[model samples]
Target: KVMGILPFSAPSCGLITKTDAERLCNALVYGGAYPPRCKKEMNGGSLELQFTDRSFKVYHECFGKCKGLFVPELYTSPNAACIQCMDCRLMYPTHKFVVHGHKAQENRTCHWGFDSANWRAYILLGQDYTEKEEKARLELFLDEIKEKFD
Candidate 1:
């Protein structure tokens, strides 16, 4: 897989562009830097014979030019007297959760981005997972991303 996220510095953040976040996500969820997936079948059947549940697990392999810095919002409210930044997108507060994969322990999840307008991202958080599982699931997701994005 070729490296796709051309690294460049972000003037304001004094780091790299935020697109790197998506790129790392894309790679971890896809195969190559472009998120390519190679599907394998375990179901016992052939195309000429029949087709059953196509359901399967997903993975997002790791592949990126470099590690992307996380832009965790800080220092201000997204919905202040003069709303600005992404946190102000959704005025209503909500709680979105992250979930684990086929194997996950109950009551295990991470929460972030509170009191911000980007609550949709928080509210839309799907599923739950452990730190180790998140890494594994992320690789699987990257594979899926490759299938769609590539």
Candidate 2:
């Protein structure tokens, strides 16, 4: 059963660039300078997620690239460079989440994102479980989440 649907967006406009997405994916798949760290915990470990604040880096980069661009109209038209920068910051994973108390207390990385073509968000689980097991685990986790919110 679907518990609830909550809408969320990135906190800032310049944070989701392709370069940062590549960097984050590399950090997750391989190893990088900034690795994943637990950003928040909720409901006594029922849910926890890894989030790194790269806002400073994103702001610096965006400003550096867009500072000098000329805007034809103030307020009415935005600078082209600024628009491009914002466009580059689209459709990246906001964070990585883990749902605890699953049988062996396994640590799983779930990637959540929206597919515009399908008009739905999907949770792609890690490869540790088979397809059937993945579905069961996800349902169990969703139930736990629903219980907490309800």
Candidate 3:
């Protein structure tokens, strides 16, 4: 099942551009970067998501204060004071979607986008699958997304 859906977008002047989106998708699918690593850091109790070119450092304190997954770039602006965080719910195995065989729950919107200056790709999280199975699933998903742009 899909634990999370991370949509990578390219926004220019606060608007998402198709060209940028396609470019981002291409670089992500073809780029020789290592697979994303999501794990807790040993030194700090923070969660780090090492994606293609950038890393998302989510501090432990932010987890409780900020709702959902916090991507600083997506929220904070140079002049903005309040950090707009995504709203997410803590789901268990007994959740409605999980119990009904749904891959992901509906109405859960969590996406990360960037301006033209920076390109980023977020990892898709899955649950209840073996490592091999999860890897195959991710590969298949990427192949399908690449096909859309091609």
lDDT of 3 by residue, 41-145 (tens): 335543333222211212111101222222223222322211111222211111111111122322223223422222112222233235797557655653443
- The number of residue pairs in model 1 that clash at the backbone is 28
- Name the best candidate (by TM-score): 3
Prediction 3 global C-alpha lDDT: 0.27
Highest lDDT, which number?
Answer: 3
Give me the runs in candidate 1 sitting further than 4 Å from their true place. Answer: 7-14, 29-39, 42-150
For model 1, residues 1-150, the per-residue Cα lDDT tens digits are: 134333333233445433344333433542211101212342442111111232112111112111111111210233211111121111111111111112222111212222222323222212233478765765464344324312
Per-residue CA lDDT of model 2 for 30-144, tens digit only, reads 2211112322332453322122231111111110121111111211211111111122221122111111011221112223342212211222222344579655765564344
Please give the clash total of every predicted structure, in order. 28, 1, 0
- TM-score of each candidate? 0.18, 0.18, 0.19
lDDT of 1: 0.25
lDDT of 2: 0.24
Ranking of candidates on lDDT, top first: 3, 1, 2
| Alpha-carbon RMSD, each predicted model | 20.2, 21.2, 19.0
